[model samples]
Target chain A: MNKKGIIFIVFLILLVLHQDFWNWDNANLVFGFMPVGLFYHACYSLIAALFWGIVMKVAWPTELEEWAEADDSREGG
Target chain B: MSTVIVIAIYLGLLLALALFSKTLFRGTSKDYFVASHSIGPFMLLMSVFGTTMTAFALVGSTGKAFERGIGTYGLMASSSGLIHAACFLLIGIKIWAIGKRYGYVTQIQYFRARFETKAFGYLLFPILVLLVIPYLLIGIIGAGKTIAGVTGAKITPKGTIPGVFPEWTDNGAIPPWFTGLVISAVVLTYIFAGGSRAAAWANTFQTLVFMVMGILAFYLISDRLGGLGAAIEQAKESHKVRTLSSGGEVGTSQLTFLSYMFIPLSVGMFPHLFQHWLTAKSAKSFKLTVVAHPICIAIVWVPCVLIGVWATGIFPSGIPSGAILAKTVGVLVKDPIIVGLVTAGILAAIMSSLDSQFLCLGTMFTNDIVLHNSKKEYTDKQILSMARGFIIAIVIVTYIAALLLYERSVFDLAIWCFSGFAALTPLILAALYWKRATKVGAYSCVIAVFISWITFFTMSGFGGEYFVFGGIVPAAIMWFIGAGAMIIGSLMSRPPSEKTLAKFF
Candidate 1:
């Protein structure tokens, strides 16, 4: 798949994970104390950070670079 | 040190930072408004992150989780983690580019130029300000309440009101009116000194202070509660614990949980965030913000949500939800210094956003209203002075509003403000990506949002959980109506000029 396609799929998964349709009220504790649902989101946030990093790398717009350069040159001139 | 003294020292330090930044300011309107677009990557990340996590994330989230359960995390944190970062990646970058390309200092300036109409700017400025004032008020109110709750006299003889305060306040806490004025004045000083540059600097410092202090508060509070394990055990036994059998799925139904996801999308339309994004030195400066904002959100929000949830176990009944965070701290920690630092941390989180919101509104008024209409060529000095003047007026207005609405909870007021802005997200998204978006379409979109927002606000009594047509949030209706208006109204009117199309495309 293309990078854009991969980004879309990852974001879709993130969205699906965000919905609390499963055993969110599960009283089962993770790591001795943390609730399972709460733990799931803690991990989800980490994965989101990683996912956005990938988006920045793959989908970072080149026009922004050009704009920045143009701006720098204008200031310099 | 006493709690009052500690808080005073912290505010003094912040004022010192603000005054220090003023000396660094170059005398220009550009320097005042956007820091001459010279803010670095680290500062951008801090300022953006700080501005986003307000009293809502700290004091309000803790209060909310005390009332609800762990599901509060699922409602805001999980969705906010992804949605806020996604907005930075998609919306922030494009808008930064447009702002840079067109010399735009505010969202109104960008929207006016995008749709090629002055009337759109006139219409938009007020709607954005109306939504943002409530947001500003929430911060002021939250700070006042946090301070009052922490400092409420523990051993009041005969339950008499404190001698300094009016008879109305039976609790010996410092009046909300006093805290509001002090906070408003301190914030106004820095923003007045250096405008956006000072705001960015102060937010960066304040964000760091709050994050470190927040984590410390969490550990200290947990230790005082006799370790994390004991706290959890107590939580399990608490009557506030969520169970599927009792229909208490953490104080929210399945539909309400799902609909709560839409609230974080409000970041996409935040005028303060727009101003922050434009302050970036380069497009690359946003990379840090986009990549790390979710991590920062998780870091700050996790401790707050957990502390609030744990409070349920500690005080199973009778604590007012808004006062739970400070109340928990007051009960758990005995040392005055620790209590003082914790209160400072809460205030830091609250004030960090206030400065940015005040500066953004001032920048908007100066650029879109004052300069846009002025036939006389104003000097940069004049423009800078005008921005500062507008900020002073706004600070006073917000201070008064915070006093009038002191009885409201931070969580509810903040949700109302976020919902109003979130309903207008469709308009912004269309402006950035949709070629056919016309001036008429933007106006119609604004009208649609106003009508839906007012209808829902009246029905919900300004701020409450009111769902429509099978538990869907009122915001979803406003969102769809606004989007539909933009599409249909654009088609009804003439399409945007090819000249405008050529610039964006």
Candidate 2:
């Protein structure tokens, strides 16, 4: 699988682990103003950004295609 | 003397900057609407951040911290900043790149193009308008209240004697309507004169002033609490520090924690932020702006949190947050002159957000909805005129709403609007990323959002005993189910033409 797939799996594992560690009464363990929680939240954002970057790169159509279409429409008409 | 002069000079400078930027407008729709796409990275970064960091941060967050302790900081303020920064880095860059390629001038325009439907755009526009109007009103009311609170303005009551409206007096108790009108007038003047470009230029000046004042206020307040260590000690002593899941029983459910993530996504889809992306000069600049946005977040959130924590120690029984805010300002400095300066900084925070929001909402209405349907060709001048007219109408409507709803908490109202956007974001994101996302799916998602949000809000209105769910829970479930439906619907139904798909595939 791709780097994004690997990253997604890692994040999924971490999220599940973190959720289990925190639970309802213990939820503060992973969600507080403490250093550990802060670090976790930061990492979560970084992973999210990375995943989004990959999705945009792989899934969306190219800018060149859009330009070419605009050109074609102008000429075909 | 220095404080009064400094504030006066700052106000003068901002107004002058607004007027100077006004010259850039040649009455063209593009020029007034999106600043002719000439915004640089520095200007764009400052404008977007300035517009987002309003009185909500300057006063509301700090006040919340004072009342609820450090949990407000961790759960609401800091999380929002971090998530907002993450959004810019992730989704912001992609939107900027796509917008540039497609000549997309508005968020709804981009949505309509990607989803291939004017109907979707039309449906989305009114929702966007509704979500934004409350935020705009908060800024307006905050500004007016701050001005009245600082200046000791007095006003006549709503149903007072004939021809006798409220006026500023030595005694306190300034009427909310009086303050609202003053703020709306000033904002409308600059907005009418310069449009988005003026708002952008004014935002830069206002942001700098706000940052300096915010940092200074934090330092002074922290010192008053006997430095950082003492402040933290006092906060701990007062039971202000908590794990993230800690809040009033109503605020701390597991679902709420999970649902908080939706806010950052909503920030990504907000129309004003989308307009900021469209105004970028290049993709690289957009990336740089996104990466740097969190730095501003750090500046605002850290100090605000400290002040909030300190307030709890100072008032053990929990001074009502808003009253504590007023008293804290009163105690922080005795001089009226310095109070005036600080007050202006607060007003700047409100205006910075208000002006940009008004400009964006106005542009969306005039350009995307009104002109989208109008057959008669409108000149750029006419479009600009309509945009200005829309700004006035929005300000008036929001101001009236603020007056009617004086008892409601600004922070709660702001969060409610945020929840609306959060509900709307998943479908928008799916349209961008998922090729199979269909118009039917998009419409269904919107329908689900309307249903879920109405149900959640109606239940909340009857009080907590009636409903087991909070706003975010139902909203998130609806989004998830709607997204699934959209994908399945698209698969079962007709897809866009190959020619259209090929343009973005």
Candidate 3:
């Protein structure tokens, strides 16, 4: 799959994992303090953040940057 | 007294920073409204995140997590983390690109120009203002409530803190209205002098303050209750940890939780956010904002949710949801200076957004309504003065409106405001991507959004959470209503003109 397609699939997976129904009534705590569901989401947020970093690096629209820079150069000239 | 003094000192510092930013103002409407598109990446990240994460993130979520449970994190904060970043990537970047190319400063300006309809501006300006009033109130009311919450406590007899002034604190605290007035004035002073540049500068400073303060509050409060483990242990027995369906006091039904995914889409249509996006110096400026937004939400939210759930054990009863966070920070952290600084952080989170909101309202009124509809031309100075004047006027008016709404929860008020904006996301989504989107289709979408929102908000009795059934949020329903209206209306009408289409595409 293309980069955008992979990003979209990862986005979908994150959305589904966001629900966390499996941990809903687990009554277990991570690190003896954090609830399972809460811990799951805290990890999820980090992963989502890292995923977005990948998107920024790979799937980013570099064309927009080129256009903005070209526009600036034209004005400068 | 020391607490109030510390808060006063913090506000004074913020005012100084914003005033310093005013020195850099280039003296044009463009400069006043969008910093002449000169903001860099880190500042953009701070301003955008700061504007989006308001008292609604801290004050609203802490209180909400108190009433709800740990599931509150999943329902709103986690979902917001992912969804808000998606919005920046999907909507914000596109808007910034188009805004830069077309010199648009307000959402209405973009919509009006894009749809080739004068009526588009007229139609959207009121709805945007109507929705933003509640959002602005979220900041104002939250600041007032938070300061009052932190200040109303004094360590004494009966094992609780009394209000600073016993005779006039309404049996134990400062009133929200007084704090609201002061916060409004503080925000107004900076925005009046410096405009959007001031907001960005102040938000950058305040975001740093609040994040540091948030972690400090988490650490201090946890130490006071023992450790993080001990604190959660204290509340482990309460419904604060369990789902509502699983014998918990709070409702974390699977369906209700899923319904909340629709709420974060509200960012896709925030006017203040759109204005913030336009301040970016380049398309690359959005990279930091898009990538860091989720973790920022997590950083702010996790502690707030944990503290709130912990509050259930710390104070078993007799605390309003809004006051829980403030009261917790104030009571547990006995030192006056610490309490004052922590509360300052809360106010910082709130005021950071208020300046942007007030500026956007001014931008909409001046650019979308007055300048666009009028025949005569005005100089840059005239436009700047008018915007400043209108923002002051809105501050007073919104402050008064806030007085009438002091009884409502920040969480509930914010949800309604967010729902109204979320219902309109279909308009921008279609306008940006759909070639077949016509002016008639835009009107239909707005009409559908307005009607459904009014009905839902009214049926919600103006201040309560009202689900369509027992499980579904009204915003979840209105999204469909809006998208359906847009598609059907567009299909039934002629496509956008080739000229308009070519300009956008």
DockQ of each: 0.47, 0.14, 0.44
For residues A1-77, write the lDDT of model 1, one tens digit per residue: 89889889988888887774665556677777677777888788898889888887878898765754344322100
**For all candidates, what are the clash counts?**
0, 6, 2
Give the Å error, residue B197, model 1: 0.8
Q: RMSD in angstroms, candidate 1? A: 3.0
Query: What is the alpha-carbon lDDT of model 2 when measured against the actual structure?
Result: 0.64
The digit string of per-residue lDDT tens for model 3 on B406-453 reads 776645777888888888999999998899988888999999989988
DockQ of 3: 0.44
After aligning candidate 3 to the native by TM-score, how far in Å is the CA of B467 from where it should be? 1.6
TM values, all candidates:
0.94, 0.83, 0.95
Which parts of model 2 have CA positions greater than 4 angstroms off? A6-77, B1-10, B153-167, B173-175, B236-240, B244-255, B316-318, B407-411, B462-475
- Which model is ahead, 1 or 2, in terms of TM-score? 1
In order, the Cα lDDT scores of the candidates are 0.81, 0.64, 0.84
Q: What is the TM-score of chain B alone in each candidate?
A: 0.94, 0.88, 0.95
Single-chain TM-score of chain A, each candidate: 0.73, 0.40, 0.81
DockQ of 1: 0.47
Runs of candidate 3 with Cα error greater than 4 angstroms are: A66-77, B153-155, B158-162, B165-177, B238-242, B245-248, B407-411
